[model samples]
Target: MSNAEMILELVRKNNGVVTAAEVTQAGISRGSLNHLVNSGLLEHASRDVYQLAEVWDNEMYQLQIRYKKGIFSGKTALFLNDLTDRTPIRFHMTFPLKYNIGVLKKQNVKCNRTKP
Candidate 1:
């Protein structure tokens, strides 16, 4: 298979979360990624991140995208905590003090970087 096809398969297996670093590690060039996006075979969900349009329905993929954006935490942590309950409308994520929490907060996701 071609590098782009291989990379696409990798993203599919990973629930649609693939980083540019990962693509390089997989021997795919950054140019190929740009080509895929331009071709509508892939979409940029975050900086340096790409996902296939096919797996967009996968909740895990959505979660990973949110996590990448720093808006996944709190009640959303319940998923990571092994608590079975209703899914949260907003996710919570913590960031280091040096990192700005503005984007997450703006998304209406709770930010608690100060907490453990």
Candidate 2:
């Protein structure tokens, strides 16, 4: 399949979201990603993150994609595990030590650090 087709397929498979690393690993060029954005086929979600334009995205899923090591912890985990009746107001994500959280900061994510 062509690079563009492969990228689109990745997005489709991932519930309408894709990451730049995934694209690059598939041998698709960054210029293709730019083209998709410019052509309105994809919307940049955050740094290295893209979503199918206008699709509803799950924040937890997006966070996982954006930060591979991040996991729902604390309040967010309780809610997800049905151990808490109250809904979590913010995502509580824990990433391994030394993980860069620049993207999470940009998205106003509540992040914590942990040992791998």
Candidate 3:
């Protein structure tokens, strides 16, 4: 199959989201990604992340993608795990003690550090 086809298949298998890293790892060129995005076949969900155009924007998913090491915590975890009905006003994520939270602090995220 073509590079564009491979990228689309990757997005489909990943629940409508795929990353540029994944594409590169699969031996697909970044130009293919640009081509797909330019053709309206894909949408940029966040830096290095892409999703099918038909998929609805999911903030939690996008954040999770951008912060792979972050774990949803507190109200965000409760809501995601279906332990609470209330939606979180600010999403919370916990990371390793040494993980940098500088960038997360700029977003609408309540960043926490895990205890050793």
User: Which lDDT values do the candidates have, in the order given?
Assistant: 0.72, 0.85, 0.92
Q: Rank the candidates by lDDT, best first.
A: 3, 2, 1
Cα lDDT for residue 115, candidate 1: 31
TM-score of 3: 0.93
Indicate which candidate wins on TM-score.
Answer: 3
Superposition error at 80 for model 2 (Å): 1.4
Pick the winner on TM-score between candidates 2 and 3: 3
Candidate 2 lDDT by residue in tens digits, 39-112: 89999887788999978867777777767778889999999999989988888999888998876776757989
* TM-scores of all predicted structures: 0.66, 0.81, 0.93
Best by lDDT: 3
Worst 10 residues of 1 by lDDT: 57-66
> Residue 8 CA error for candidate 2 (Å)?
1.1
The runs of at least 3 residues in candidate 1 whose Cα sits more than 4 Å from the true structure, single-residue gaps closed, are 57-73, 79-84
Clashing pairs in 3: none
Question: What shift in Å separates residue 42 of candidate 2 from its native position after superposition?
Answer: 0.8
On residues 1-116, what C-alpha lDDT tens digit does candidate 3 reach at each position? 99999999999999999989999999999899999999999998889999999999998988988888999999999998899999999999999999999988888999999866
lDDT of 3 at 91: 98
lDDT by residue (tens digit), candidate 1, 1-116: 98778888888888777888888998778999999999999988766778777755545445455465354467777876779568777666766656676655666466776532
lDDT of 1: 0.72
Candidate 2 residue pairs in backbone clash: none
